[model samples]
Target: MNREGINVDPQGRVAIVLVRARNPLNIGAAARAMSNFGFDDLRVVNDYDVPFAEARSAIDAAPVLAAARQFGSVADAIADCTLVFGTTALGDRRLQHPVELLRDAGPHAQAARMAGGTVAILFGSEKTGLSAEEMSHCHRLLTIPMHRGGVSMNLGQAVAVCLYELARDGAAPRTLPEEARPATAAELARYETLLREVLVTSEYDRRFPGNMGEDALRRLVRRLALQGDDVEVWLGMLRQVLWKLRQ
Candidate 1:
């Protein structure tokens, strides 16, 4: 239930995806938090079913966990989602995607959902946060500021914090028309694959190896911020270019 005056996701366009989460208790905690915030679309990406089954058995998380869907990978989990945000601790790893502070992410994330797009927030496992491969699917990353440099919040706590921030100051939904909506992750992934093929066919990757890595190319494709309608147009153009390059 949304607060009396706040309606962040009136149409149920936001989803929470937990990737590789191993702790059933933490999963229960995350589900409980989702229930508190009126979000029920929970997706779990795990190879095994034990953790999810165990979490769903918890009485407190029954509402959210009972309806949760499990997936094999992040790509499959977020395929229909138009906006994907990954959470991270900003460790010693280099990041290719843009980063936003959690407090400031709510407005931006809400905007995306309001624009007739499904939004997905990805929470990684309890032991380690989102891996580089998992994060490549995200357009941006959000991080909660910590008092201590290396101290990281627990997986469940992190989910609660991020969702709480997202649910605050919500207003009336401002949905866009179908054609004006942003491209979904599956659409973007298709576009990225086609674009990469074009580059490889034209030997651009060979010419500029430094910027043609998987992560870099994925970031570059996302940076374009293509809309729903623009994806096919770009794909067609790239297909033509690739054909010509092959000829």
Candidate 2:
């Protein structure tokens, strides 16, 4: 039996995002892995050669490459997705997003997909990994297990490993009851904007300059995993504060 036919539900809802990858070959290889795992949605953020689809490594996955979408930034790429996971090696940097082992992330992705939500798994550039700004857009960070002294895996291999785990775990039936749909990236973005304006009005940034407080507050909001209603409530509360401050 073809694996494609077996696990078809989440294929369209899950996207593989490559951020500022420099090598066309690596992009091709990532596309090939998506082909192997039955995930077709590919979103590339920033400055990738258009001919990457024709790389020799892409092999029979040319179609996946041909249909890939390009975006200006991680935020634009994942605007439609309700759940976003950024893949990180987690070397030494302190991160705000909750870190989950790659093995354990599959169920979370699966649950989001089962709940009729789109999921985006982000793979950063091979050289620098995800920048702090890019990772902030993700709801969580996923790290593949490796030995303490192990060298970092190549970009394509990282995508393959994460997708394989997700595909494997996605075969299991969802056990959790349905709940309110999570807020979209755009919704959270709007909420962030309003909250920032409120903070500025309240002189929160003046007291704590360089936008440190604003950045921390953004991460805190993302970590909350707010739903649509939750976002609306927060937006309303913040807007009210902003309005009263003007009074």
Candidate 3:
């Protein structure tokens, strides 16, 4: 579909993720929104009830609801997605990932999709928003602007707003001097493992035990927004350092 000046094919590259949605009707509403925005990929993480596909609110979005994929965890749901965005109302909870305003996220998301990378936008349940653990899987945190009353939105409405902003076209895609390709989750995991090994070998973990060091390192790496080639280079460097430390 043509969004603003950009052509966005929402079928393959963009996915709408509902995490532990309690009401099936809300799931249905989310599906309907996806249909309106021309997004077909819907992924549900963890357990949810409400016979989503049969939801009456889904309207003509039955196909999208019926075809939705279910996953046991956030990691599995977004494994194939190069960019994962978790939507939050920015409650009192602490966040590790970079937080972006919904308006600013559109161009970045569209650019990622245009670069042939899959993107997943995640929404939490009606009762509780995404836990810190679940949010850890996301590359960035997305928050919608709200009044100072501290009120949050319903799951369905949140999904609709995010999709609308993202699907709306604004400016032409920026040109990169080099072809831009972000690292896949698998690549990032490999680099994380190698880097962790180097830390252990270098006794960095010993100096900072528990989640302090590990979490900090993980967050630092994610903030790097490494490209595919950067992953290889870092992995090789970490491996070499690990070998030298062991020797």
Candidate 4:
């Protein structure tokens, strides 16, 4: 696979997500890094439009920059991804997800791509990193080891480091069939919404309010790890249950 260069199953299975990145130069550099590693799916979650526009206008900007898609939120940016990884600096913030070192995460990400899953790696802003709410969307978190004195990396540098590690593995075979594809984050989110409604309608929230927080329910559904076909069945069943409760 090294000879073939990033043997992704459906062409583009890896996406780089930037949440609240503010620097135009960093955005351009991030795009350049994606191009360097032969990745093109760049999703930016930024409300401000000027930085994205300026990055695209940069003279040395990569082609991926021109075609990058802008999203209003991290959830929307990563909705189509089947597996989401968030990069963190491991500061004093309390974490709710399991964390993996940067070196170890590449194989897992490559394996996800080989299984026909779209993998998304998210990078937070230049100032503060991913918010607690944004980090909750990830299945697992990845952290780059740093010297004791170093707190974090620059936005563009962090993007480059993560992509470099991922690109180092150029030999994994792309083998999964389309039918075997896992359910996307978008589908899982939709299922979560419906299930939440069912819980509300059935008075489960009132009876068992302990487990009804949005983050808790989201983690609960993700723990199921339903496949594409399974999510449809579950959605149908939940709909029926909701309807019956309403009646």
Predicted structure with the largest lDDT when compared to the true one = 4
* Residue 230 local lDDT, model 2: 87
Q: By TM-score, who's the top model here?
A: 4
**Which ten-residue region of model 2 has the weakest summed lDDT?**
1-10
TM-score per candidate, chains pooled: 0.64, 0.62, 0.62, 0.65
Misplaced by over 4 Å in model 2 are 1-8, 48-61, 170-247
lDDT of 2 by residue, 1-247 (tens): 1244544464659999999888888888898898878888998886655545345335465678878888887889999999999988999899998999988887788778768899999999889999999999999999999999999999999988887777663443334567998999899889988978887888888887766565677787789899987888888888889999999
Root-mean-square deviation (CA) per prediction: 23.3, 23.2, 22.5, 23.2
Off by over 4 Å in 3: 1-7, 10-12, 48-61, 170-247
Residue 188 in model 3: shift from native, Å?
67
Question: What local distance difference test score does each model get?
Answer: 0.85, 0.82, 0.80, 0.86
The TM-score of candidate 4 is: 0.65
Error of 2 at 70 (Å): 0.9
- Which candidate, 1 or 3, would have the higher lDDT against the true structure? 1
Predicted candidate 3 versus true structure: per-residue lDDT over 1-247, tens digit per residue:
3635445654558889888887878888898888777678899886544554346345465677878988888998999998999988887777888999999887778788889999999898788888888898888988999997866788878888887786555332333287769999899879888878877777877887774366677787788899998888888888788888989
